[model samples]
Target: MLHKLELIDIKTHKITKIEFKKGLNVLHGDNGTGKSSVLEMIGFVLFDFLPENQADYVRETHSDKPEYGKVRVWITDIKGEPYIIERTVGKPGVIVKDALTKSRIPEIRGVNQLKAWIGRNILPMHEIELGKLFDSSIGIPQGTFINPFLRREGDRKAYFDPIMQLGVYEKVFKNLNELNKKFEPDVQGVSETIHEIIGEIKIKEELLQEQESLNAEIISLAKKLTKSESKSKGLKEKYKEIKKIKEQIDEAQKKLDELNIKSEKENENLIDMDSQLRDANTAKQICDETKEAYNKHIKLSSNLEILEQEFEKLNAYKEDLRINNENYIKESTHLKQLEEVLKKAETNKKKLPKLERIYQEHSELVNKIKEIEATIVEINAKEEQQVKLEEKASNISKNIKSLKETLVELPELVKKYNIMKDIELRIKEHEIDVANLTNQLEFFKNNQEKINQHKCPFVDQTCKNLGEGTFNEDIFNNKIKTKEISLQDIEKQIEKEKEEIHEKEIFREKMDILEKDKTTIENYKAQYRDYQDEIKALKEEVRIKPQVIKDKKE
Candidate 1:
């Protein structure tokens, strides 16, 4: 219910206030006295439409410069809560406020907000459009009731659809038709995919047949490889036996070489032994002479050792006597010094009380100084705290000033932020729309031919009724290119796997050969060690043979 309407400076006429009653109201006036202007203002405020120019509503009796005209409508909601809606003539915005709270309802800016506000607070959406609602139900315009009787049948039905609320059913049917159109393409694409899969199945069957033939050939090769491996194994065993025999022969040859070396060393040793035998008598004679001379030297050395021992005893006794004399001299000097020190101690004992008194005074003064220093340190700390507090207060003042300035601009900033947020929301909605379009494009590309063949159930043209646009052949070509790249990748992966398998087989064969070579090397190393041991023994025997012969000669 409209409780009040206030208008300012409206076309040489100003309506300051107009009040209405609860149930029924009437306005009757002369033709030029602005009777219809009130209804026009009501339509402009509520339904955002006016029969006359909004600028003409400006008062001509006002100042020469056009002044802003305003319309404020006060209405009661369904719950009887009062709301005030204000609009300025020739302005682009409206303001809605809670009359009780006097607080503005934010976000009521343009026609959409006004409509939504009216729907939520004053009337239902269909009733908020006063022209339509009045024409259809409550109040008929001058010619509206007679026009439908004169119209054609189709036109009459069209006019009646909104009155009977049959347009909603038409919208629902249209949406269902669009949904069916969208699904038809998907169904056709699926059918085409099934056909492609069937064709691939036939190709796979042929490949399987070829694979079976390859498997047979592989089995034949495997049998041949097994036979070759068996032959190689037998040959390796024979080679091993031959290697062992060769090692034995080499060992025998090494021993023969050692025997020959030993024989030659022994013959040389025989010659050296005979020469030593001849020199044996002469060496024994020389040894006897050296023994006689050694006995005389031993007797002389014993007499000299006895004399030297007696001389050392006499020298030790003299050294002891000299040490005693030096100690007696040191004791006499020390005793003299001690007597002098005793006299000095006696002299200093008289001054001990005075020194003790001075020390006590000095200790008292040191404690007093420390106490004074502690007090000074505490005072400095308080002064520093006072300085810090002053700085803090200055900072707080600056912050308060800044806060006041920010508060002044807060409303405008909030409004801008809201506008930016709305723009961001719109951008995000557009991004979502783009993403949906991209997905639809990709879908069509992936199934272009199939979608192209799909026909709309309601329309004769293929894909004509689709909610999304028709398939793009360029996108389909790109999808084919992508699939081709993927196929190439798969082929490369298969080839890489085959090469890896071949390399692994080659590595295994090499490992087998290495194992055999390692065994052969270990056997050879053991044989070489045995040969070295035999050579060492032969050399030792050759060295001792001459020693034995020399002992026998002796």
Candidate 2:
């Protein structure tokens, strides 16, 4: 409730002040005595609006027109700070000032800052006609008339809805009660018994996994035994074949050594031809050197003849050049004297025209520049005054535009405010409904244990609805199977396989050595044959040079 209200310089009046009472108070007078405007003035100050046609809309739209629509309100604080709320209308912008400090308050749109201030600092008007409460008119006393608080068509569903919800609450309660009756002892015993059974099942599962891993290991070892048996048999057969081949090779080598000695005696004449071929090669090298020097002497004589011809040509050209030099010097001196006279004549010819054109252009441009500078100075002088007027005009125009916008927004503001009031009423009804629902929820929360443990008649269906307590055996079985492959069991199998691979690798290395031994034996047999041939050839060389061989022996 407003404690006091004052209107100052609002519309036609220069100044007006009014006071208000704390309790329910009405501002009343005959129809056109500015009584309605007083309410408008209160709205303007505390809420910011004025009735239509109370003030001239045109003059009010200018920012500088006047602060004629100012209103002030004084209120008591039941909560926090209280001050007179002042609002200025009929200006470009609305001004809301806190009376105590004289500082302006920020204007809030959509939500009322002034009303919120009152809510925080003073008692908010309590609303009793919550739409849902006592919704049916039958609840009211028959002939004791009640004040109309809202339109008859205003939604009253909130008052009737909770009555309908009692059925839902009844169903929830009946289910809960039945659930509790069947629960208690069975739930208490099963919870403990189920935990013990699950513990035993977990132990059994671990034992089953260990037994399965041992079985897998036994099977793997059996396969390894079968493969090892096969490889051992193959190695024995190859060893026998290698021994037999070695015997046959030994017999052949003995027969070849005997034949090699007879063949060397038949090849002794072929060795003597190589000595004659060496002397013929020495004579051919001496002949090649003597031919190269004879060609060098002939090339030097041809170069001497060319030099004699060039000497005669130089002697004739020198005499001709001496005669030309004397004539050139004489002509050059005469030409220089003529060139000097021509330059002087040309200089005088160019000076008069070039200077006259320069003076004419300079005189013209100097006069033109002076006129431009004077014009620039004149424009500069007026710039300051023009700027001042432009600033003033701009400020006035901006203020006028702002005032017009606020005036135009006035109707919208009232419409929004009314809509907001309706929303607040609806919200109050919802709050009551929510409070009732919360009370019902507390009843359920207080009985949770009984509900969770109840042997529901539709246990499966209840589980389906509640999404609880369904054990997936297939997923669990697959998981158990996966767990059966213990890491230790896998590591043991890996070690056995690695050991088998290592044994096979060693066997492969032995086979490789056997193959290399065969190659080395073959190469040694070939080298022995070559060494025998060289010994026979050296004996033949000693027979051909017997004296040299005899001297070496001495």
lDDT (Cα atoms) of all candidates against the true structure: 0.68, 0.54
Clash count, predicted structure 2: 3
Off by over 4 Å in 1: 62-65, 126-145, 169-554
Which window of ten consecutive residues has the lowest lDDT sum in model 2?
A: 129-138
TM-score of 2: 0.22
User: Which residue runs does candidate 2 get wrong by more than 4 Å?
Assistant: 21-28, 47-68, 91-98, 103-112, 123-554
Candidate 1 structure lDDT: 0.68
Q: Residue 351 deviation, candidate 1, in Å?
A: 65
What C-alpha RMSD separates each model from the true structure? Answer: 36.2, 43.0
Clashing pairs in 1: 11-57
lDDT of model 2 at residue 189?
93
TM-score of 1: 0.31
